[model samples]
Target: MPRASLWFIRTGLLALAAGFTLGALLLLNKGLPIYPGLWRLLPAHIELLLVGWTLNLALGVAYWILPRFIRGAPRGPGWPVWAAYGLLNVGVILACVEPWVASGPWLASVGRALEALAAGFFAVHAWPRVKPHGV
Candidate 1:
Protein backbone atom coordinates (compact mmCIF):
# COMPACT_ATOMS: atom_id res chain seq x y z
CA MET A 1 0.00 0.00 0.00
CA PRO A 2 0.99 3.58 -0.49
CA ARG A 3 2.12 5.79 2.38
CA ALA A 4 -1.03 7.88 2.16
CA SER A 5 -3.23 4.78 2.31
CA LEU A 6 -1.56 3.94 5.58
CA TRP A 7 -2.40 7.40 6.82
CA PHE A 8 -6.03 6.84 5.93
CA ILE A 9 -6.18 3.62 7.91
CA ARG A 10 -4.41 5.20 10.84
CA THR A 11 -6.86 8.07 10.84
CA GLY A 12 -9.80 5.69 10.75
CA LEU A 13 -8.38 3.70 13.63
CA LEU A 14 -7.88 6.84 15.64
CA ALA A 15 -11.47 7.80 15.08
CA LEU A 16 -12.60 4.40 16.27
CA ALA A 17 -10.39 4.70 19.30
CA ALA A 18 -11.90 8.05 20.14
CA GLY A 19 -15.40 6.61 19.87
CA PHE A 20 -14.56 3.67 22.10
CA THR A 21 -12.86 5.93 24.58
CA LEU A 22 -15.93 8.11 24.68
CA GLY A 23 -18.15 5.17 25.47
CA ALA A 24 -15.84 3.96 28.19
CA LEU A 25 -15.57 7.45 29.67
CA LEU A 26 -19.30 7.81 29.73
CA LEU A 27 -19.68 4.56 31.58
CA LEU A 28 -16.97 5.51 34.01
CA ASN A 29 -18.49 8.89 34.62
CA LYS A 30 -21.82 7.30 35.42
CA GLY A 31 -20.47 4.62 37.77
CA LEU A 32 -17.66 6.52 39.46
CA PRO A 33 -19.28 9.94 39.60
CA ILE A 34 -16.27 11.36 37.89
CA TYR A 35 -18.10 14.50 36.93
CA PRO A 36 -21.28 16.40 37.53
CA GLY A 37 -22.81 15.75 34.14
CA LEU A 38 -22.00 13.03 31.64
CA TRP A 39 -23.69 14.95 28.87
CA ARG A 40 -20.95 17.56 29.04
CA LEU A 41 -18.50 15.14 27.46
CA LEU A 42 -20.60 14.51 24.37
CA PRO A 43 -19.39 17.29 22.13
CA ALA A 44 -15.73 16.69 22.81
CA HIS A 45 -15.90 12.97 22.12
CA ILE A 46 -18.05 13.43 19.04
CA GLU A 47 -15.72 15.98 17.56
CA LEU A 48 -12.67 13.86 18.27
CA LEU A 49 -14.16 10.95 16.38
CA LEU A 50 -16.01 12.87 13.70
CA VAL A 51 -13.67 15.73 12.94
CA GLY A 52 -10.30 14.45 14.05
CA TRP A 53 -10.63 10.87 13.01
CA THR A 54 -13.21 10.81 10.22
CA LEU A 55 -12.30 14.07 8.59
CA ASN A 56 -8.60 13.36 8.78
CA LEU A 57 -9.07 9.95 7.21
CA ALA A 58 -11.12 11.46 4.43
CA LEU A 59 -8.47 14.08 3.76
CA GLY A 60 -5.72 11.48 3.69
CA VAL A 61 -7.55 9.54 1.00
CA ALA A 62 -8.02 12.79 -0.82
CA TYR A 63 -4.33 13.54 -0.71
CA TRP A 64 -3.57 10.28 -2.51
CA ILE A 65 -6.52 10.47 -4.89
CA LEU A 66 -7.21 14.13 -5.64
CA PRO A 67 -4.11 14.84 -7.67
CA ARG A 68 -5.75 13.60 -10.85
CA PHE A 69 -7.18 17.07 -11.25
CA ILE A 70 -5.47 20.46 -12.37
CA ARG A 71 -4.71 18.91 -15.81
CA GLY A 72 -1.08 19.80 -16.36
CA ALA A 73 0.54 19.95 -12.92
CA PRO A 74 -0.19 17.35 -10.28
CA ARG A 75 -1.92 18.50 -7.10
CA GLY A 76 0.70 18.48 -4.38
CA PRO A 77 0.29 18.96 -0.69
CA GLY A 78 1.11 22.40 0.70
CA TRP A 79 -1.36 25.18 1.47
CA PRO A 80 -4.71 23.52 0.79
CA VAL A 81 -3.94 20.21 2.45
CA TRP A 82 -2.39 21.83 5.48
CA ALA A 83 -5.35 24.17 5.82
CA ALA A 84 -7.78 21.26 5.84
CA TYR A 85 -5.81 19.40 8.47
CA GLY A 86 -5.55 22.51 10.64
CA LEU A 87 -9.24 23.31 10.40
CA LEU A 88 -10.26 19.78 11.36
CA ASN A 89 -7.94 19.68 14.37
CA VAL A 90 -9.05 23.13 15.43
CA GLY A 91 -12.65 21.90 15.46
CA VAL A 92 -11.74 18.94 17.65
CA ILE A 93 -9.71 21.10 20.05
CA LEU A 94 -12.52 23.62 20.43
CA ALA A 95 -14.93 20.81 21.23
CA CYS A 96 -12.89 19.80 24.28
CA VAL A 97 -13.67 23.09 26.02
CA GLU A 98 -17.15 23.47 24.63
CA PRO A 99 -18.98 22.01 27.60
CA TRP A 100 -17.43 24.01 30.43
CA VAL A 101 -17.31 27.32 28.61
CA ALA A 102 -21.09 27.51 27.91
CA SER A 103 -20.44 29.44 24.72
CA GLY A 104 -18.41 26.49 23.38
CA PRO A 105 -21.06 24.88 21.23
CA TRP A 106 -21.38 27.87 18.98
CA LEU A 107 -17.63 28.06 18.61
CA ALA A 108 -17.38 24.32 17.97
CA SER A 109 -20.11 24.57 15.36
CA VAL A 110 -18.18 27.28 13.54
CA GLY A 111 -15.09 25.10 13.62
CA ARG A 112 -17.06 22.17 12.25
CA ALA A 113 -18.38 24.36 9.46
CA LEU A 114 -14.90 25.52 8.61
CA GLU A 115 -13.73 21.90 8.45
CA ALA A 116 -16.53 21.09 6.05
CA LEU A 117 -15.50 23.99 3.89
CA ALA A 118 -12.00 22.56 3.85
CA ALA A 119 -13.45 19.32 2.52
CA GLY A 120 -15.06 21.32 -0.23
CA PHE A 121 -11.64 22.63 -1.13
CA PHE A 122 -10.42 19.05 -1.61
CA ALA A 123 -13.42 18.27 -3.80
CA VAL A 124 -12.64 21.26 -5.95
CA HIS A 125 -9.12 20.01 -6.40
CA ALA A 126 -10.51 16.61 -7.35
CA TRP A 127 -12.75 18.03 -10.06
CA PRO A 128 -14.20 15.54 -12.50
CA ARG A 129 -12.71 14.85 -15.93
CA VAL A 130 -9.26 15.70 -14.74
CA LYS A 131 -8.45 12.04 -14.45
CA PRO A 132 -7.45 10.29 -17.62
CA HIS A 133 -9.87 7.44 -16.96
CA GLY A 134 -12.61 9.90 -15.93
CA VAL A 135 -13.27 8.18 -12.62
Candidate 2:
Protein backbone atom coordinates (compact mmCIF):
# COMPACT_ATOMS: atom_id res chain seq x y z
CA MET A 1 0.00 0.00 0.00
CA PRO A 2 2.56 2.52 1.22
CA ARG A 3 6.22 2.77 0.25
CA ALA A 4 7.22 1.17 3.50
CA SER A 5 4.64 -1.54 2.98
CA LEU A 6 5.95 -2.09 -0.51
CA TRP A 7 9.49 -2.42 0.75
CA PHE A 8 8.39 -5.01 3.25
CA ILE A 9 6.32 -6.98 0.78
CA ARG A 10 9.09 -6.91 -1.82
CA THR A 11 11.65 -8.01 0.70
CA GLY A 12 9.36 -10.84 1.77
CA LEU A 13 8.89 -11.96 -1.81
CA LEU A 14 12.59 -11.67 -2.52
CA ALA A 15 13.28 -13.80 0.48
CA LEU A 16 10.91 -16.44 -0.78
CA ALA A 17 12.50 -16.47 -4.21
CA ALA A 18 15.90 -16.66 -2.59
CA GLY A 19 14.85 -19.65 -0.49
CA PHE A 20 13.44 -21.62 -3.36
CA THR A 21 16.23 -20.81 -5.77
CA LEU A 22 18.99 -21.33 -3.25
CA GLY A 23 17.40 -24.50 -2.01
CA ALA A 24 17.38 -25.83 -5.52
CA LEU A 25 21.00 -24.84 -5.95
CA LEU A 26 21.91 -26.58 -2.75
CA LEU A 27 20.18 -29.69 -3.93
CA LEU A 28 21.94 -29.41 -7.25
CA ASN A 29 25.28 -29.13 -5.49
CA LYS A 30 24.64 -32.39 -3.73
CA GLY A 31 23.34 -33.95 -6.88
CA LEU A 32 26.20 -32.98 -9.15
CA PRO A 33 29.48 -34.74 -8.52
CA ILE A 34 31.39 -32.20 -10.58
CA TYR A 35 30.55 -29.42 -8.19
CA PRO A 36 33.40 -29.21 -5.74
CA GLY A 37 32.82 -28.34 -2.14
CA LEU A 38 29.18 -29.08 -2.74
CA TRP A 39 28.97 -30.51 0.70
CA ARG A 40 30.43 -27.39 2.25
CA LEU A 41 28.20 -25.20 0.19
CA LEU A 42 25.16 -26.81 1.74
CA PRO A 43 25.57 -25.13 5.11
CA ALA A 44 25.93 -21.66 3.64
CA HIS A 45 22.97 -22.33 1.43
CA ILE A 46 20.86 -23.34 4.40
CA GLU A 47 21.86 -20.27 6.40
CA LEU A 48 21.22 -18.00 3.46
CA LEU A 49 17.81 -19.44 2.84
CA LEU A 50 16.88 -19.61 6.49
CA VAL A 51 18.06 -16.21 7.64
CA GLY A 52 18.20 -14.45 4.32
CA TRP A 53 14.92 -15.78 3.05
CA THR A 54 12.74 -16.94 5.89
CA LEU A 55 13.81 -14.60 8.69
CA ASN A 56 14.06 -11.55 6.45
CA LEU A 57 10.68 -12.19 4.88
CA ALA A 58 9.18 -12.63 8.31
CA LEU A 59 10.78 -9.39 9.49
CA GLY A 60 9.62 -7.43 6.47
CA VAL A 61 6.07 -8.71 6.77
CA ALA A 62 6.17 -7.89 10.43
CA TYR A 63 7.35 -4.41 9.61
CA TRP A 64 4.57 -4.04 7.08
CA ILE A 65 2.00 -5.45 9.48
CA LEU A 66 3.17 -3.54 12.55
CA PRO A 67 1.30 -0.31 11.80
CA ARG A 68 -1.97 -1.97 12.67
CA PHE A 69 -0.65 -3.08 16.02
CA ILE A 70 0.17 0.33 17.35
CA ARG A 71 -1.74 3.42 18.25
CA GLY A 72 -2.13 5.99 15.50
CA ALA A 73 0.52 6.15 12.75
CA PRO A 74 3.58 5.04 14.79
CA ARG A 75 5.80 8.13 14.66
CA GLY A 76 5.78 7.96 10.92
CA PRO A 77 7.14 4.39 10.97
CA GLY A 78 10.24 4.99 13.08
CA TRP A 79 13.78 5.78 11.86
CA PRO A 80 14.81 2.17 12.09
CA VAL A 81 12.73 1.27 9.07
CA TRP A 82 15.46 2.36 6.72
CA ALA A 83 18.17 0.92 8.88
CA ALA A 84 16.34 -2.36 9.08
CA TYR A 85 15.84 -2.55 5.36
CA GLY A 86 19.35 -1.49 4.46
CA LEU A 87 21.19 -3.49 7.06
CA LEU A 88 19.14 -6.63 6.67
CA ASN A 89 19.42 -6.67 2.90
CA VAL A 90 23.06 -5.68 2.86
CA GLY A 91 23.97 -8.17 5.53
CA VAL A 92 22.15 -11.01 3.89
CA ILE A 93 23.72 -10.18 0.57
CA LEU A 94 27.19 -10.06 2.04
CA ALA A 95 26.55 -13.18 4.01
CA CYS A 96 25.57 -14.94 0.83
CA VAL A 97 28.11 -13.42 -1.51
CA GLU A 98 31.21 -12.83 0.57
CA PRO A 99 31.61 -16.42 1.60
CA TRP A 100 31.90 -17.36 -2.02
CA VAL A 101 34.11 -14.55 -3.25
CA ALA A 102 36.91 -14.01 -0.76
CA SER A 103 37.80 -13.71 2.92
CA GLY A 104 34.57 -12.49 4.49
CA PRO A 105 34.72 -13.18 8.16
CA TRP A 106 34.58 -9.46 8.81
CA LEU A 107 31.86 -8.91 6.28
CA ALA A 108 29.91 -11.82 7.63
CA SER A 109 30.34 -10.57 11.17
CA VAL A 110 29.29 -7.08 10.24
CA GLY A 111 26.39 -8.55 8.38
CA ARG A 112 25.45 -10.53 11.41
CA ALA A 113 25.59 -7.41 13.53
CA LEU A 114 23.50 -5.51 11.02
CA GLU A 115 20.92 -8.24 10.98
CA ALA A 116 20.86 -8.21 14.76
CA LEU A 117 20.42 -4.47 14.74
CA ALA A 118 17.57 -4.93 12.33
CA ALA A 119 16.07 -7.38 14.74
CA GLY A 120 16.56 -4.90 17.55
CA PHE A 121 14.71 -2.33 15.50
CA PHE A 122 11.93 -4.79 14.96
CA ALA A 123 11.74 -5.51 18.65
CA VAL A 124 11.66 -1.86 19.62
CA HIS A 125 9.38 -0.81 16.81
CA ALA A 126 7.02 -3.64 17.49
CA TRP A 127 7.07 -3.37 21.24
CA PRO A 128 3.53 -2.15 21.30
CA ARG A 129 2.42 -5.29 19.57
CA VAL A 130 3.76 -7.44 22.36
CA LYS A 131 1.00 -6.54 24.71
CA PRO A 132 -2.05 -8.73 24.99
CA HIS A 133 -3.49 -8.73 21.48
CA GLY A 134 -7.09 -9.34 22.52
CA VAL A 135 -7.06 -6.50 25.01
**Candidate 2 lDDT by residue in tens digits, 29-66:** 77775567555555456666778667766766766655
Cα deviation at 46, candidate 2, in Å, is 2.0
lDDT of 1 by residue, 1-135 (tens): 446446555866776787679878987887888776876777777777766777777767766665354455455444655666566666567666777786976977777687787677656645542466433
What lDDT is reached at residue 37 by model 1?
Answer: 81
Stretches > 4 Å off in candidate 1: 1-16, 30-36, 66-73, 128-130
Residue-level lDDT for 84 in candidate 1: 60
Model 2 ranges with Cα > 4 A deviation: 37-40, 67-76, 132-135
TM-score of each: 0.69, 0.76
lDDT of each: 0.66, 0.68
lDDT of residue 13 for candidate 2: 75
